[model samples]
Target: MQLAQQRRAFIMETVRRDGAVRVAELVERLAVSDMTVRRDLDALAARGLVEKVYGGAVAAPGTRVEEPGFDAKTALAGPAKAAIAETAAALVEPGSVVAVSAGTTACAVAARLLDVPRLTVLTNSLPVAELVRSASRDRGEAAVPTLLLTGGAPTPSAALVGPLAELVISSLHVDLLILGAHGVSEEAGLTTPNLAEAQTNRTLIGAARRVAVVADHTKWGTVALSGFAPLDRIDCFVTDAGMPASGREVLADTVGELLVAGAE
Candidate 1:
């Protein structure tokens, strides 16, 4: 293989095994100059294959090993998230109730849902709830469906946690649930890094008649700590065109429909 390709492969492999890696280690492992390692790290960061951090590089947050901070995730796939959110928003008919999970992608979907009319949104994400409220106020529409915030302990990423969140989720029935995942695999299904969050997601899924998973391309084929739901439970999946063919095929085999937004 070419030097660049070999370097990238080595970096990814190291991060996968060690959960995180530093630039110095990469330079030593590849026998490449520090400048060469930095360039490789930059390229990987641009592709969302790895994250560039202070003094080193780390595995991308959504991968099984590293739980990415909210800011990092929000920046990873801005355009793809916008497209997925827009497509998902279009699926909601007027006056329908939708349940959204707590994730950056789901937050984007909430932002898009702001344009829709007379809808009720139920969510376990503080940020999503705030977005919905802001949108409702901006439109000056009082008739919009109530925005319910599941009250609970806050996770590092502002995810509502604890039993209260699950109780709130179980209390409502919704027409659609737009969810996000830490990782998705053909065998392990949809997974989340936190058990409390997974339990909350399960409650939301159980209460919805239809489930739509909103995720960017990079989330595919990874594994996390807790499995939220099996692939068969999902009614639809909305993702960007950049999703890998193998992952698409796996999703197609598992879910009822796979909608590729922004695809040529």
Candidate 2:
């Protein structure tokens, strides 16, 4: 079972690397039977990692299986992320406890939160904790003195995700959760390719009184490997103006509130 999981991970990586992968190629590369490669591709496709094509598979359209570096994600959808972050931050109340999930957009939300007075933040994101800590130093310890960091195994995106992180997250509750995702879709709702991250995110969702998902327009229709929440589970969906009217309509109907940030 463990070996199968590892092989599936390798196949997912291959599809991500070249945008598509052939069953014959995998058979040759892994010294596995054609049946074995087909089964692996089937499993990956079922998990929304790849799309099975003729004699091959392609990365799921507009979605990804491999986690990108934090800096790389930060470079994407810059204007949209800024706008989404500002809009999402507006949901925070002064002097309230908030939980932030890990991602570049979540870090942006964390940065926007500095002006709020005496806010205590609980987060599994290393970048978010670092950002808040630096801000506190600049303004004095009293500015935002209470930033809780969960210690766990780190993900590729600089997030502490695993059993240790989930254990800490499960014991605490916050007023709101500003969550980020590797991808979002009508089918998957909220998802990440990293299974551990998905588990950690599920814990974060349970710990929060209200959940707000922050995603750029590009995330629409993208589905990752593991889904933590369906659309109805989200309390609010905050996105940028780049979202089309059709997407906006669907979100407004499905989520509690759909807030779109204007041009940055």
What C-alpha lDDT do the candidate models reach, one value each? 0.82, 0.87
C-alpha lDDT of candidate 1 relative to the true structure: 0.82
Off by over 4 Å in 2: 2-10, 18-43, 46-48
Per-prediction TM-score, please? 0.75, 0.87
TM-score, cand. 2: 0.87
Q: On a 0 to 100 scale, what is the lDDT of residue 62 in model 1?
A: 54
In model 2, pairs of residues that clash are none
lDDT of 2: 0.87
Expressed as tens digits, the lDDT of each residue in 1-264 for candidate 2 is: 237767887787777778888888888888888998898888878767788999999987676677788998999999999999998999999988999989999899999898888788999999999988887778877876389998899988999988899999999989999999888777678888898899899999999999999999988877776788998999999999999888888898899888999944
Instruction: State which candidate has the highest TM-score.
Output: 2
Best by lDDT: 2
